[model samples]
Target chain A: MSEEIKEILEGLPFWEHLEKEERELLERESRKVFYPAGASVYSGARECLGEIFIQKGILRTYLLSDEGKEVSMYRLRQGDACVLTASCILPAITFDVEIEAQTDVEALLIPVGTLSKITKKNVYAENFVYKEAAKRFSDVVEALQQIMFLSLTQRVAAFLLDESAKNHSQLISVTHEELARQIGSAREAVSRILKQMAKKGYITLTRGEVKLENKEEMYKLLN
Target chain B: MSEEIKEILEGLPFWEHLEKEERELLERESRKVFYPAGASVYSGARECLGEIFIQKGILRTYLLSDEGKEVSMYRLRQGDACVLTASCILPAITFDVEIEAQTDVEALLIPVGTLSKITKKNVYAENFVYKEAAKRFSDVVEALQQIMFLSLTQRVAAFLLDESAKNHSQLISVTHEELARQIGSAREAVSRILKQMAKKGYITLTRGEVKLENKEEMYKLLN
Candidate 1:
């Protein structure tokens, strides 16, 4: 188990810069955990779930509104580390966001204090944390711009194109309800837009799936 | 002039953590620049301006849509450092947002390489950068939630209440167009909502200004 943990640490770019003592400290302190799909990993303002480094699968982070609406923020995939869940390091900020497993997942959890100690001693780890935070910050800003400036139809179209590229297919297997949650709109509104797109020959929609009928037309909607 | 710059640097929380040699290096390398109100500080994705530490006045960072609609992201005030403008350090991320002076501003510019070197060598500097980045990320996420889940009326009401608190008075001197931009809405839509709030006895509207008549009523709209 110790050898396995050391091997994983050695594979990470940031861990390469650490001294042998620091690497050994992290290997000894960090623990691996797993979650099934649909499991709640962390929630609320005060829970500090440590710094999570995803070893496999997907994690979805989102916000819940008083009206019971869910707005997807962003997702963490393999090799991505989430520092926001460890709010004890950021006492001035609140962590009201919820993190859930989108697939059966494995991750290494570094206790907040241990991560802080490693960062204090290792410049590479510190730089990695700042860069990741900045990247996530840019992602949130991009999402805000889309929500505020893009019309619902434009957003839906853009989302479809993005998902298609990620899946490497013209056909996307997502329900209208899931699509609506992804774009922070109502299911009825998403369904209406998809139906209109289908009528316009931009896409073809069926139960629990949508396929691009004309990729060129769909890309044009992005602008 | 050098003495004045040193005093400003000493006043900053991050500077205190630096070694004396690092502080002297910063004093020698940093340049102070001024921006008149309404002057553009930074724009476009290709321009990486370096780390900006605000010495005085306000800077508004916002996004511009293809149709020229403006959406306010956040603002930087005295003693605040903006890493968004220092995109060279975060090369994987794009800084497409525009930053403009909301008031006549004085700031210190540490060239990207210098700031990067300092952060790499100093644990305190790295921690400070990570903390600030995390805080800004949290701010962007909060704004995203508001735009996605809150109604325009509710947002306007919340904005009025927030402005009143910031100014420490019920009367806020801002044009409807400015308020509209702040909340990423149309001037006409903001005016209509303000008119409704005035009629409902929650606020009083005048040319270029708004007065909160019932703070309690405005707070109720937040829920």
Candidate 2:
């Protein structure tokens, strides 16, 4: 198991930066973790979950409001390393969010003790953390800008277009509830907007799926 | 000038992490900059403005949309160290923001080359970057939440109350335009809301100031 962890660690970008001894030490200490699809991966505040390096599948990170609105922050895909999940290690990260596996997953969790020692002693390891946090910082700002500047319909339109591009199909297999959860809107509100879009010939809504109709009109809504 | 720079550098939290030679090198390389109230501090994309440490006054970091809507991200107060400003060094911070001096400001700008060297060689210096980025990441999340869940009225009420507390008085001496800008609302929208608040006797809006008329009522609006 430890040898497998070492091989996985070597495949990561930070692998080249790790000193030989520290690399071996981290491989020995790090543990592999798995979460079934739709399972809660991390939640609550300041519970050092350790840094997670996603090897397979995706993790959706979102914030829950007092009224239970779920605002998706961003997703961590394969090969992504997350520092925000291990907020306990970094004292300044005071807030917490929910992370769930979007699919059956495989990942390595670098335990807190091992990572702490490396960050304390290894500038390269610490530099990796800074780089990851900096990357996510800009992403959060983009999310903030979207929420502040775009209308709900605009956001819905943009999300649909983005999904269509990624899936290489106009048909999006998402229910109203899932769409609401992903975009931080009420399900009823999402339904109402979808109906309006359907009436406008921008999309065709079927049970559990939405298909883009007039792609240009839907794209126009994004602006 | 370099001697003065050394004295100021000694007062910062990251000063002790520097080696003796790095300290002298940084002090000589660093420059002091000042901005008058409400001047744009940083703008554009992928430009390394260098790392800035605030010595006096405040900076408001904000995003501008295509239609010219300005959304305030967060503020950088005295003693704050910023990494997002120097996005060129950290490739992950791709989003650009307009930073404005909220007041008369004095700050230290560590040139990108010098900072790059220290962060490259010193774990502690790199640790400071990670910590600062994490702090701001949580703050950006909070700002996003406020925009997501809070209504325009609730946001206005909360902003007025926060400003009152900060100024240590019930009267917040800011114009409607300034209030709108601070909380990322339209000036006319802020006026309408303030009018509604005034009608409810929750607050009194005068020529260029807002006085908390009924503090309890104003606080209730936050919820």
Candidate 3:
């Protein structure tokens, strides 16, 4: 880890508590890899393999059923932890889904066994992992609640707003198909809704990018 | 707790490793209370409360949105722990949902403050709590995946199978309105599907009870 990326990792809730030495131990065990679009970083069961920190680019978590239906469970952005959310845990964690790079991606993959070794020897590491698990668990539950209760339009608006915040850019690169999978809707329906929102002046769409024209106006539709 | 219920609790992951005396402490703190059908045990925005162990009857967990729309999150049956699932360790947990008794009910409540104290002092207790949290987290995530990916009819069938297994009965006492909220659909739509399923001999429906006549056939539909 470079001084810059190490500083960022140190800011992360999970790694923040580790002593400089312990953090180095983690860094030593971790393998930094870059994957191009459509590559699988980890392809296996749903078992808790540990955690991965997204250093760059975008990843999508999806499940493919035996019949080949694709279900997009979540998308991973930079600074996100893969294992903390859903990767591999005991009691047989098989990913009915696969993790795919949406674009060129860089990530730090940590094995669960390595994490367990460190945590077992260090109280700080143990507490950090537990806390990280708790936080990620809450996020997954919140996402579940949102999907259950929020309307499709509300979901799209929220997703757009979140993406805008994350990138700090009004313009985000996404296709209708990807958006539909993220919000668990049909591609055609998402396209229609996006078109309608664009016509209403809340957003503008172009090839490979959508820009929010009026943030306040779009938020009002969240209700 | 009686010897019988104590045995049951001991079998649960949370109580499995506790010393007999330590287990007795939990038993002493627990008090059984009963509620009539249609009673609200806890409401939204309530503080992080104690855990509840269902001794008898069915309970529903649901959120009442700002627009007064009710979204059912999960159903709690006998032998389930409610407080463990509702803990607010960090990020300041808020009760987004209410717990309501769907039938005459009896449950044991364990205060969160006491559990916190126990966890701080007892390693076993802390481990038990963390493990329970992890398991519950997995359960909630699994449910979200189902909701996001599964077809409406598939979800309904799977829900019926789950309820049947929990209650150990073919007949489940759930109104169309309750089923609709659980599955995030309209009550009329749920009714239409149930009626159709009944006509096809998949289930038998009375005023408020539904019984699966053929579990195998229903499971096939869920796929």
lDDT of 1 by residue, B1-223 (tens): 4776777667766787788889878888888989999899998654778778898888888888888888887778887888777766655455488889988999888877788888778866766666676667766676777777789999898788877886589998889998898888889999999999999999998899899999998898887
Candidate 2 stretches greater than 4 Å from native: A2-4, A12-21, A167-170, A192-204, A212-223, B2-4, B12-21, B45-47, B117-123, B199-202, B213-217
lDDT of each: 0.81, 0.82, 0.71
Give the worst 10-residue stretch by lDDT in candidate 1 chain A.
A86-95
Clashing pairs in 1: none
Per residue, candidate 2 scores C-alpha lDDT tens digits across B1-223 of 5565677678767778788999888877899989999787888553668788898988888888888889888888777887767766666767878788988999889888988988778767766776687788878888887777799999898888887776689988889998898888789999999999899888887899889989898888887
Q: Give the candidates in order of TM-score, highest first.
A: 1, 2, 3
TM-score of 1: 0.90
List runs of model 1 lying over 4 Å from the truth.
A2-4, A16-21, A120-124, B11-22, B116-127
True-structure lDDT of candidate 2:
0.82
DockQ score of each predicted structure, in the order shown: 0.55, 0.67, 0.33
| Candidate 1: tens digits of C-alpha lDDT, residues A29-73 | 988889999899888664677788898988888888877789887
Residue-by-residue lDDT tens digits, candidate 2, A1-223: 6666777778766678778898778868889999999998888653668789898987888888788778998878778887777766666767778889987889999887788888778666776776787778777887787778889898789889988986689999889998888877789988999999999989999999999999999887786
Q: lDDT order of candidates, best first?
A: 2, 1, 3
TM-score of chain B of 3: 0.79
Question: For residue B3, what is the lDDT in candidate 2?
Answer: 62
